[model samples]
Target: MHPVEDHGAPGSGGSRSAAGWLVLLALAGLAAFLLARPILTGPVAGLPAVAQSSSPYTVHRPAGGVRGGGIVNVDTELGYRGTLAAGTGIILDRDGLVLTNNHVIQGATALKATDTRTGRTFPAHVVGYDRSNDVAVIRLSGAKGAGLRPAAFGDSGKVSEGDAVTAKGNAGGKGGAPKIAQGRVTALEQTVIARDDSDGSSERLSGLIETDAAIRPGDSGGPLFNASGEVVGMDTAASAGFKMAKKGKGRGFAIPINRALGIAEQIRQGHGGAKIHIGRTAMLGVQVRPVDAGRTGSGGQSADGGQSGGQGGGQGGGAEVASTLPDTPADRLDVPTGAVITALDGEPVDSPNTLTDLLLRHHPGDRVALTYRMPGGQPVTQQITLASGPPQ
Candidate 1:
């Protein structure tokens, strides 16, 4: 045919097309190598590190980092900024009243809680607290319809150290998300000292489980689970260092769930379906830092300051008073929200810590006179009986 002798093969156009594809493939391969250089070299080349460069294993966590069960690596985040909304809680009764650590709500007074997996949020209220036990009960508004999911409680007495344990918490809120951790109980009946940063005092606690699983601040009040998914303890405090204890901030502690259930009973029966037992009233619910010469509230805690912190005259706390129960002693005496309580029962009230200490000496349904400033700008003296709700 036309150039049969000179043409190397038939369908020369096909050969040209194949050659073009080969060129394209080479170019693509080169581009891929160029773009992937970072991931390939930093770790593969054994160079130092840059952000986002790591080996096949292990990730990074900052001071705010959060994770779940077993160091097995689930979702991660920077830290807690009050973003978490819901976690596994105990359903103690048919009334749909749930029990959790008061701190889980962080004194929100009211909140929206949703199941981590279901994405359902419901309105919740602080029902009560038995302070000495640090257990709080919350009543879910319209719990039946709010997709309320209740967790079962495992007997702390039944749990032994070195047993497998699981911890679940809403660490990042939307970012940290929900995570689980797997660990063995390293220590049982461990004595831990906890400092309420709000008041700046330390608490010596016993009967706490020591685990190797990572725990964070927001994890407080969350449920510590067992292999069968039963709760053993309420995540309370991480083992931290004081001037006295040099241990780093890694050990996490939980109030025994069985203990929490006992205190929850009082709160479930008392004031308007909410029982508040004042066990310890010495701790204030605010954190303070030296501000502009005098002092100011550093963390979201009250700026008014309280006696629980490192050093204070007696007591001072700066949490916003949302409101008082109606017809109750506090309400009857006209103790209104927005009043910064500087003292209670003649004790200088600065933080919830001081109040907690005072309450410790009293019983539920006991009446105490409180002097407070009126929101309308008046310093008033009034005596109000303290009605009990739940254990703090």
Candidate 2:
């Protein structure tokens, strides 16, 4: 979903001023046009551009004979926030059903998919999302030409450490042609926390296939192929650096193709499982801003000389409540604006994203405990049932 950091730009919650909105717009432009495409930006016009550095992998070869008809370049618009996000997808059926990471299409208003083989683009739409599994499905009803080529799937169960593999995607977010990177299966049944450094949202992922392949930004949801050219996994996340690489070679992660296809089948059949959010997001109905830096445990005092509530025993940083949706969980719990959220379910709230990341672990209709305090007051804890959120 990213190069070194996640896609999209970090969003601020505290203020709703016009200038704030403008800043967000600028960030959106930078993310979509600059970062997404890996192109030069302001003050660099007419300058010679440099090529991407080689992957830090060895014992690899070009994926020349690998089939790429099923790979698609995925792009989505974060509607309300005016940002564009990019990733990759694999065609699952002749009718253009696509499988991708949930984060790829989340909060999307407009979706466009580009076929790797034909270079044809199609308007795509979300079918469903499994936030817990970080998987999603989209349909491309209007794809041009003779439809799509479904990828041949292999048994992920057959994968073993040291197995040969190749990865493909729209590396660098360039949608024209998918890039190829080769490596070997380094581990299996891996568990990780896939994080979005931009927005601070993170997902706990498990049962993953780990590889030393060079997965890049815009590669999320792309295919990981075995030596026989069959899809064995779906490229998902990559480590920022290789702990074992003296030169810092990084590793990549993927969802087993078997697991990915199972979820896709359920989504196509309209199965709304307990962990799946169909066409909606699970939300707590509160807007918050990150606590200012250099503040003590009490978040100090508000700039207006008003009390800002105690910081309590939360982590490094915490979120200051800006507002709560009327009739929602936070409002029902009487979580007043300006209160600082210190913890959730006993876990410290280090930042706005930390709260968001933790809340995403639960689904709609789930109940969570929150700890907070009003300005200059002691901490208070309450149990609140989350509600289905509006489409972003």
Best by TM-score: 2
Best by lDDT: 2
TM-score per model over all chains: 0.52, 0.62
How many clashes in each candidate? 59, 2
Write the residue-wise lDDT of candidate 1 on 241-345 in tens digits: 211333332456666655666566555555322224423222222221211124333322223332333223222342234444344455555556555454556
Q: Model 2 residue 292 lDDT?
A: 50
Per-residue lDDT, model 2, residue 170, is 78
Candidate 1 ranges beyond 4 A from true positions: 1-88, 93-95, 145-147, 175-177, 196-199, 241-249, 271-392
lDDT of 2 by residue, 1-392 (tens): 43222244444221112211111011111222212212111122232222112222121111222354578899775544545567899888777788998757655657888887888888988888776677888888676445577777776767887888999997767577878889988777776664333433334576777788877767888999999888888887766543234322667888887777777777777776556545544567677766655454454544221122224344334576777756778878888877777787887775554565566556678887888767665678898887765322
